[model samples]
Structures are given as structure tokens and as C-alpha cells.
Target: MVTPAYRMIRIKNASSIMKIIGFLYIFTIASLVGRTIAALEFNQMMGLFTPGLYQTLSFLALFLIMFVGNTGFVILLKEQVDQELLRVASFDDLTGILNRRTFVLLAKQIIAEHVKKQKHLSLVLFDIRYGGDEFAILLPEANEAESDRLVERFRLSAVQAGIPEIPATLSVSRGVVTIVPDQRTTLETLYNLCDRALYDAKGNGRNGAARTRIAL
Candidate 1:
């Protein structure tokens, strides 16, 4: 699945510039050999080979073309490499969701933006006690009912409908934390609250959601 997408995002004939350089070298050597043979066999002087201004300009143009072509090739390779590295670093290989590190980073950024704007921001984390991994959902500009509905949808998707390439054994019973922060709430506080709520959800029956909210 990933292979086709990776193949498409690449430079076409990226090494062609190198081939062109090799061709130029061979052509120069062959031309010199032919010239030497003619001078010896036919007594031709072969004229002065000193390049004129036009010849110098043409040579520079060729060099410029090669330089540009090679630079583009390098750029394409770098882009593909960067994308692959980012994908591997940012995603969970099994679940196809954001990895824990990426989740926190993006959540922090989103919280900061929404906090400044004084907009509605909700965070829902699904603590899958049985599946060995957690699924977190961040909802910006959303209410409690909205957040609950989203989490329930995700739960059904995991438990009933199922994600592609994922086992159906993954549980969606969650510990949820929702906060409408004022001036006092911090990122650490939000994370701790969510974790506690997850514990509460697990403690209850290990297959339900618990919510704790900080008032706006």
C-alpha cells in the first residue's frame, strides 16, 4: 500500500544529468581521436582550437543547464526522503494514528492557538485497556455532547466497523477528559486530568467513558 505512493513521489530520470556528462566526455575523446588521425593521414592542420566568445558562452550555458538539472534532482530526492522520515516518525505503524509524541506536540500547538482565541477546544482520549495502545482525539471549537458523539463514533468504528489492517480485538471503552480552560489551566494539568479520567473509566468496569470538565 505504501509502496505505490512512495514510488509516485520521485524524480523522473533524476540521474540523466550524470549520463549527459558521461556522453559529453566520450564525445570529446572521440572527436579528438578523429582529429588526430586526420592530421596525420591527410596532412590537415586541424585549425586553432581556441574558443571564441560565442563558444565560451555556449560552454557556460551547457554548464548552467547541467547544474540546474542536478540541483532539481537533489531537491526531489530530499523531498521524498523528508516525507518518508516524517511519516515514520509521526505515525503509529500498526494503528495508522498519530504516535504519542506527535499527538502531544500537535495538541500543545492546538491548545495554544485555541486558548488565545478563547474558542471552544475539547480533548478526547480513548484508553483502550485491552489493545495495548491509546487513541486520542482533539476537537477544536466543540462542546461536551459533540465530543462524546465523536468518541462514540470512534469506539464503534474500532469495535464494530473496524479499521483496515487492524485487529478487531481493540477496545474503545475510554477515560475521557474535557476542559474549558480559563487563565489557570496548563498543558500538564490537562494531560493529568485526562489520565485520571482514563483510570476512572477503567476502574468503573473497564468498558466505559468517564468525563471530568473544567468550567469556562
Candidate 2:
């Protein structure tokens, strides 16, 4: 989730940079004009230079400043943009859940650790039907407040339906949940059970929760 504080910081940085850029642009233009005028006066008074020579010198200086300043500014902007994009990509924007990429990586790590310890481990994959498309439609029709309310309701249902005995950790993406079980279950059995439960939830309708059972 993008916290209010972080958003504020981003806005502040953006505003500051825009102001700096604006000032730089104005200063550059003014300097160029002033140099041209000064050169023209010196040439007229002393006959040491021509208008073309003065203009060329002024243009080269202006072009160099523009090249360096604009290049640096563009690089900085790209870095900031990339950082923001990475943060957004790592989590679900709507429900503030960990995205699928994060879930997969976490699952693999946990599974490897459990295997080393000779403990049982399981993986459960869950999906909510049409959740992505449904949210896209709802987001425009309803305001963020309303959309949040809808997401919260579904999240609450899921949490309440979670099986406490399983020692499970869950990561949610756009419309999917991946559960990593600790010490208590076999992967194949738990997956089948959870998958069936998920199907049942889907059968009943969206916005519900279901869990797979451990096979004996």
C-alpha cells in the first residue's frame, strides 16, 4: 500500500523539481537573450566581432547547458519513476495484498526451509472469479471509498473463513491467494483440498472463502 506519508513525500519532491525546472528554463532563456544583446552592442562599438560570430558563441553555450541540465533531469526522473513502479508492482493496488510475484518467491523460500527442517509443507492456490474485471468496472462507477468498502467486505470474509489449525500464511494477488502451510500438511493433499474448497466458494458465488482439507 502507498501510505499517505509516502504520497505526500512524492508530491513534495515532484513540486520542488517542477519549480526548479521552471526556474532553470526561464534563467536559460534570459541568459541567452542577454548574451546576444551584449554581444551585439560590443560588436557595434569595437568592430571586433560580427553578429553571426556572437550569435554562434551564445548558441553553443546555451546548447551545452541545456544538454547537461536536461539530461541530468531526465535521468533523475526516470529513476524516481522506476522506483515508484517497482513498489506498485510488488503489491496489489486494490486490496493492499502481496502480488503473485511476491507470493511465489515467498512460497519457494518457505518450502525450501521447511524441507531442510524435515517439516511438512503445503501450497494452496486460490482465485476469485472475475475479480479483476469486476473491480475495474466498479472503480469507475463507484468512488474509491465505495470500492474500498467492497474490497474490505471480501477480505473480511476470507480472514474469518481461514482455518486456524493449519498454521498457514496467505498472500493475495489481484484475484488469487496462495497459502503456505507450516509443519502440518502434505503439499499434494492440501492443494487438492484447498482447490476443491476454492471451487466450492466460486460455485456459491464470488466474495466468499473456502479451505481444503488434509487427506489422511
lDDT of each: 0.67, 0.50
The residue ranges of model 1 lying beyond 4 angstroms of the native Cα positions read 1-67, 129-132, 162-170
Give the candidate number with the greatest lDDT.
1
Residues 73-118, model 2: lDDT tens digits: 7866886898789879887887786676776566556555654565
Worst 10 residues of 1 by lDDT: 1-10
The TM-score measured for candidate 2 stands at: 0.31
Query: What tens digits encode model 1's per-residue C-alpha lDDT throughout 34-151?
Result: 6667668967665555444433444554565467557756865786798789999999898888998998898888888777888776766666645546666878877788888987
Pairs in steric clash, model 2? 193-212, 194-212
Q: Which ten-residue region of model 2 has the weakest summed lDDT? A: 133-142
Best by TM-score: 1
Instruction: State residue 177's C-alpha deviation in candidate 2, in Å.
Output: 11
TM-scores, one per candidate: 0.61, 0.31
